[model samples]
Target chain A: MTPDALEGALRRPFAEPANDRVLDAAREAFEDVGIQRTTMRDIARRAGLGRATVYRRYPDRDAVVAAVLMREVRVFLTWLDERIDHIEDPAEQIAECFVAVVTGLRGHSLLNRLLTLEPAAALPALTVDAGAVLAVARGYLAAKLREHQQAGRLRSFDPEPAAEVFVRLAHSMLLSPPGCIPADDDAWSRAFARTHLVPVVTG
Target chain B: MTPDALEGALRRPFAEPANDRVLDAAREAFEDVGIQRTTMRDIARRAGLGRATVYRRYPDRDAVVAAVLMREVRVFLTWLDERIDHIEDPAEQIAECFVAVVTGLRGHSLLNRLLTLEPAAALPALTVDAGAVLAVARGYLAAKLREHQQAGRLRSFDPEPAAEVFVRLAHSMLLSPPGCIPADDDAWSRAFARTHLVPVVTG
Candidate 1:
């Protein structure tokens, strides 16, 4: 279908499918010129949309960037869910999650580029901002922990705090992996999860 | 004592007492104008020495900055040792260390200023760059862990890697504390250490 027709069909009251197209274009522009230099016009042009339409969808470049980052995070979390959905044991599930997250982030082209080129902008969200993405991550993990606790698969603890620790640990390693843990070593990552992480939520 | 007399009394073969003066001067300059803008001449002027004397002590501004950073780390380590030296329990020691470090960094004038004014230059040491300061921190912790393990107080783990995790966790929290954990809550910080950290080094 044509871009116009596709957007018209995909646009919802709260969100639109065109949002994805605009963000994808924004991601490309950001990669090419770096986030600091990429403009709304560039994204609009790349998305095959008028500046007015792009502005209607996203008010500014910062809004577009936030959408792009959130979209990326959602996509990654979806992949993560699928990867560890079948694991029965919480320990195994967390271990797999750690290994998968580290491995996935290591290969993530856009995130790696941003970390290398635009760390000043990107690092704050992972580190200091504690914004929507982190809240979503913590909520997701907490729900899982709660579910397992109800099912008698896990011990009783404050799942929110436990999930918070898990999320921060994952973020810390991804942003600035410890020197002692050699990168790309899945066995070591899993072992670390088992040794250091598994005990946090378990009895 | 006069500067010249002090230098004669304190100078060694490889490093001289003047090095301390130069580094102290550079630290002040870095704190005032930031590492990026602070020049060797500024440091020399602050040290009450000639440009040639400062240059002889440190080859360049970067060298002076490195020495200043190392000196600061040494001072912090000395303080940390004194604070946690009397804690007998391994878990208690680790927990207190985390609280003390977070508290210390929060109050540190130079570090707080650098983090705010020159994050681009100062952040790498805590995150990406594995510098001498980080190495010294990890080594100090590892030595304590090793001693504890030998005394049968903690688990038998690779002290270096364990120390690396401890150091990185502290750095992560200092650099980007989790939103889940409230800042400046000594109780929460200690609980986090007891829950997540003490396990790694203790059985």
Candidate 2:
């Protein structure tokens, strides 16, 4: 898909405005205060909606947080899909995808704030829902890896596990970045991917 | 070092009995309640020591908790050192280390309880001190990778970044394990290291 197509998809209005507003407000509040401290009333106030409206849309704070995270993942995948679909080489595609994700997440304001200001509250949401979240990412990568394998562009391996490692590595770097690697630099990501990621995925 | 030598080193008693007792008590108290809820009084009572003695040993709850965690890390590293010292193959050594860590952490009662019961409290300790903790792990791995590179057992690559990736991957898996890969299984860990880790270190 073209970048314009991806942007168009992202720009499409949510079917439920109240839900979208609640999620946006929750994301902002989560970044500002934290998940544990943020209340439904605060979210409602931020969204410019009544408590009843917020309640009707999201049963509780967890629901709103989950919605926000799901939305973030969807947006990230859309952005990634647009740029990587045309890359023919499996290693290059995977490398580019990793670089894009690291750079994209590094620049993301809410995510960066959440990790920095409120890690305790943020970590639980990520850890407990890790399986579900990783399933989405693994599915995306596994499908791509399988395609490459079938086309003789990648080596034989169980794409699911390989993709799982890739996704886990990305999540780890994104959340608790070990500054040992230059994650903010795209050249570093590509070189690191060539030595570390490509062999894992293709071998 | 031989197994017996390692055991002998571990058998050496702590320099200060009061410090050891207080730290042990703090760990238990943290596990029983939580970091936020556990008080100096609770720790003193758990240690079977008077309030004055506990105060003299540790000024506050945070100090006691930090001491406990530092001691725990030291013990874990010592134990790991004993097990991995004899393995000559860099790949095998690294794989065994990862497997040992995953398996050891899975069975750690206090850590598991803390993570499961009071993630909001436990997560802060991990995240706030992530730099210090990763530095220790990264330093150890980088040293090993460099030694291997010098010995011609590993290929030419920047060892620091490679070590960072290795350590980060382990930390991520330890905290929020992805079920897509069976990290707890020894055979699986070995296979994974051979395919993924060996290449990263030796490429």
Candidate 3:
């Protein structure tokens, strides 16, 4: 699939239940045996679908992995929207968003397994090959920042750069997880966002 | 070497000219043929040292690579001290430091070649196995931040976390440069540091 189509699928709710089943099976397989050991046949077997059926939908294991990851992003985005939709202050929204994303992803079983068991396989997707993931996240954040700007709740500067910074910071924290940051603590995350992150957009 | 010994060696100015020759040779070999292709014998040959001598100093190729990398960090820290020594304002010091580090490493021939030609091999030392590197950088930045704090030029905060943030951001940019940030531009990096990075410490 094209990048735009994949992005669209990521943003929109799952329209195909069959695809959801495949993604679920793939995620389970990855979590169980890790990405290195998981295969198309395994995913198909877990999903109770024929190998040809799974292959018809996803051309290869990589495609299936990408689809599962995209689905996870969509799920996280939906959860983020629900969690932060009620916060009135843009700064608070951003802070809570940061906390939610860091902790949420940290708690994801499949992601945690992949990171621990298959760092070489997983690191590239989250780091160097993360253009699509970063773009989706940046888009989501920029839109929220823009909304706040239009409402006069946020100071007017280019939200795109600020959003990108936030995304990169979160990305780095999740991937490397510095020993210094209390990334798991909600209170610390909020205070940190207020001090370091909110100012970029507010300035 | 013990971790403490490694840290001490990284901080101290090069004392052994013979080891320096070995490192210089290893760097040249790494640059010429890449890390995977360059063996300890090649480094020894290039350094005009016997294989037994090289093996005596460094138990294996990884040890030599680590030592060479540590030397690079020392070189960078010395350069950073010289670059930002005269800046009175803590914020400007931080900004210039950011610019110097990001641009300097980006321009480093060995690091650039490794990143471009051998990402899989180069990435771990910079990411998951980057604790030592990150710790050294954090120590440098934290000490600078502490100096400013004591001088009343910056606000009181945990400099370690703030320093880690700076290091991690630079790490992320170097590893997976986002499209939105003009990371290579000095002016842009300065502005970004001023807006986002400075506040974490100053606040």
Candidate 4:
């Protein structure tokens, strides 16, 4: 499926209160026992909703998982927007965004837990099946780059591919950070971004 | 383990003729039944060697898998070296290297089969447990960048981290491959490397 379609489907469940309850319950269950063991009925029981109600909103557990993951991405994007909104320099903004994403994802509880406990389940979502997450993040960065271009702070370039490259750098780093690169160090991440990532936009 | 140590171990099996036979058999078995189902005994039988001989070389199936992957990396690196041997400009060389790697990997039968049939097994080796592979590739690029620096073709920077970034970009692109970025297109990949990757070295 196209990333936009997948992202739209993921966002649809956010509009309903019942869906919110379902996601909250799914998150709790996932944290308690893990995603592999969290059944549809278990989610319904935890949410205090009927099985049919949960099914009406989400066709199966995978859909619920995708929705939960998308919500987390939304939360992350909002936090990222707030952090970088004040920065006017395109280079520094991009650098700080990279730092924030790497640090934020490193501290993310559910993602770390899933990686540790159930890599089989978590790896695919982050790697092969990461379309929705990648789409949302690339969109966020592309929009920011466009704004920077409009403000005459950045040159005219296809922001989409540049944004994808930036996002992928962060994605690869978080998944399997190389030994040469320091992890979770704010100063190091910032410097690396300035040297490596800023050029992608400014050049 | 350190990447150097892992790489050293991965290369050790190459000195033995029996090890080559074992790896060939293991590759065949992996291509036939997939890595998850390929066993030491199966490999030994296919190689016309005793189980003790196989066990003596590799303590387990995981070790065999690592050795096979490392061998493939070595072969690819050799091919890459030959392909870019005559290029004078560092930017064009890096661009061509990226194109070669992305295209070479996309057509790799064993790696492709594993990624398609047993992502659970393949993903970790490329992502979380990718230290050896990443180390080998990064080391190769760092050496090349260092050569450029020595020859005054490129400015001095920590070639190590820069190389890691290059390798990780290719790594992530091969694994997830965002929709915004065109795939398996030589012109696009080369242009991307020039626009996005060359800056990491030249800037």
Query: In candidate 3 chain B, what residue range of length 10 has the lowest lDDT sum?
Result: B1-10
What lDDT tens digits, residue by residue, belong to model 4 across residues B1-203?
Answer: 33454346445657678889999999899999998888788999999999999999899988888888888887787778889868878999999998888878777889877877888887776777778788888888887887788899999888888888888877778778656777679999898888878998786
Tens-place lDDT digits, model 2, residues A47-113: 9999999998789887787778767876777678898989999879988998998888788887777
RMSD of 3: 3.9
- In model 1, pairs of residues that clash are none
| Candidate 1: regions farther than 4 A off | A1-15, A51-64, A118-126, A130-132, B1-16, B35-37, B49-70, B130-132
Question: Which 10 residues in a row give candidate 1 chain B its minimum summed lDDT?
Answer: B5-14
Question: What tens digits encode model 4's per-residue C-alpha lDDT throughout A1-203?
Answer: 33454346445656678889999999999999999999999999999999999999899988888888888887787788789979998888888887888878788899878877877777877877788788788887887888888889888888888888877877787677556777768898898888877876665
Name the runs in model 3 displaced over 4 angstroms.
Answer: A1-10, A16-19, A47-60, B1-10, B17-22, B48-65
Q: Residue A85, candidate 3: how far off, in angstroms?
A: 2.3
List the global CA lDDT of all models: 0.72, 0.74, 0.77, 0.82
Q: Which candidate comes out best when scored by TM-score? A: 4
Query: TM-score for all predictions?
Result: 0.81, 0.84, 0.85, 0.91
Model 1 lDDT, residue A150, Cα? 87
Question: Candidate 3 or 4, higher lDDT?
Answer: 4
What's the iRMSD of model 3? 2.0
- Which candidate has the top score in DockQ? 4
Model 2 residue B127 lDDT score: 54
Which docking class does model 1 fall in? acceptable
How much does candidate 3 score in TM-score?
0.85
lDDT of 1 by residue, B46-121 (tens): 9999999888877976566566666676677668888997888999999999888888877788877876677766
